[model samples]
Target: VVKWNIDKAVKGDPDYIVDRINVHYNIGHLQAVGGDSTRPAGDYLLALNKLSKDQYLPVGPDLPENQEIIDISGEQMKMLASFPTPPEPHDAT
Candidate 1:
């Protein structure tokens, strides 16, 4: 996840402030409800991770996708839960 200062960004002053946490594996996409049009975004975010790897039990070469539930309601983002998904989950709401 990433954190940005909107006030600085609007003035074109490099507002990217932090790198946040590095999830278990590679993340394909990050999404939230009403994210695009919402002013403060949403209180939660779903990290669509591509590979399970060490995140779950070994299931041969083909690893299940991981959907990481993140809590963005507070000052810092936190991983709340993880659910194994079928193979490739292109997108989520």
Candidate 2:
């Protein structure tokens, strides 16, 4: 997870901080309920990973996509669960 000062960003300053955790595969898209709405954002953040890779059970040549459930209730993001999707999902809400 990364933290960026919006005030600095508005002034064209590069005062941003970044923190990263290994989610185990390539993540494509992410979404949370009411994330972009006026209401409060959801507590869960879903990471749509493009490849399961070494993160899931062996499926030989047909590896399923991964959906990593992340908990954003605290200061840091925590990965709660990982689920498999046979078909790749383009986006989520």
Candidate 3:
């Protein structure tokens, strides 16, 4: 459900998704202190990739065979749509 949508959003725009998730998830100052700050993004992608394949199952019983079928609720879809789109690049020609 939520996980699938998040996966889609992450795949759609890794940079934007990572930035927002990092800020929202708040890995904090210790994790952010480094020249290679995109580690958080990398870690997130790694985790998502693992989950997507069912390689890393949850702690309890296995989920359904079909996986979770997710329909974007009207409110959730609207919220996602409301997020401001990335700014367009200026024509330099």
Candidate 4:
């Protein structure tokens, strides 16, 4: 996940990137809390990955998909935690 320092971007800074974090393989969806609404939901984000890969322990030949929870309530986005989802490879909904 890349968190751009928009404060710097607005000021025409060439390097506006402030933070970057690794997520699971092949991200399918990136949903922000209350992002569909008009209200502010700037607290959390969900990285719906299409593949878990080495992010979690494998049960069989297939690795389960995952939802990586990211904390966006601070100056820098932090990967708080993650959990393995069902066998569905791309269940963003």
Candidate 5:
């Protein structure tokens, strides 16, 4: 027997929801209901960003402190200081 609850549960996730909405809207369904235009654009975008959490956050300014780290160590530091050539890449033949 087909299990409707299981099927519905899988289809109801956030990724599934976003994908379905995008597919419908993008494929000539300009007047699709309950999508971006129906909701306040700014509010909907903000909610989507919050809902997506790890995926949609802006890259640079507001990223968590630990995420954007420019580690200057070893050869990187030497090169920046104009010290000398670092090391040539290994030729794997």
Candidate 6:
């Protein structure tokens, strides 16, 4: 996850990048609490990664879906925890 400070963004700011935290394999979708609504909560974020990539083998299969909880309350994004999610047959780009 890359936390950006867009409030102070200017032309020379270089994408307003504040910090970054790596997830397991491939990050697919990201959902912050209330992020899709008018009242977006900025405290935490839920990251959906497409592949676990052996990070969680006990969960089984070649690769499993993963969800990671990240703390975004501060200037940098921090990885708090991660868990395997049930596979979704449908794929949405």
List candidate 5 segments past 4 Å from native.
1-49, 63-93
* lDDT, ranked from best to worst: 4, 1, 6, 2, 3, 5
Candidate 6 per-residue lDDT, tens place, 1-93, comes to: 778777658556666888888877677887888887898878888888875666666655556678888999987778898877766423221
Q: What is every candidate's alpha-carbon RMSD to the true fold?
A: 2.8, 3.0, 18.1, 3.1, 22.3, 3.8
| lDDT (Cα) of model 2 | 0.71
Q: Flag the better candidate by lDDT, 3 or 6.
A: 6
Question: What are the per-residue Cα lDDT tens digits for candidate 1 across 1-93?
Answer: 776677877888874564386678788988885676747467888888885666677687677789988887777889899899867887775
Per-residue error for 92 in candidate 5, Å, reads 53
TM-scores of all models?
0.74, 0.67, 0.14, 0.71, 0.13, 0.76
**Predictions in order: lDDT:** 0.77, 0.71, 0.23, 0.79, 0.21, 0.74
**lDDT per residue as tens, model 3, 1-93:** 122347657578643332222112211112111225543331111111112223233544542111111123333311121111112211111
Question: Highest TM-score: which candidate?
Answer: 6
Ten residues in sequence with the least summed lDDT for candidate 6:
84-93
Q: What's the C-alpha lDDT at position 62 in model 4?
A: 80
- Best-performing candidate as measured by lDDT: 4
TM-score of candidate 4 against the unseen true structure: 0.71
Which residue segments of model 4 deviate by more than 4 Å? 53-63, 87-93
Error of 2 at 10 (Å): 3.7
lDDT of 5 by residue, 1-93 (tens): 011234556777533221111110111112112334455322111011111223334555553111111112221211111011112211111
Better of 3 and 4 by TM-score: 4
**Tens digits of lDDT, candidate 2, 1-93:** 443457777888765433344576677877776777899575877778886666567676677788888887666678898889764776776
Cα deviation at 18, candidate 1, in Å, is 5.5
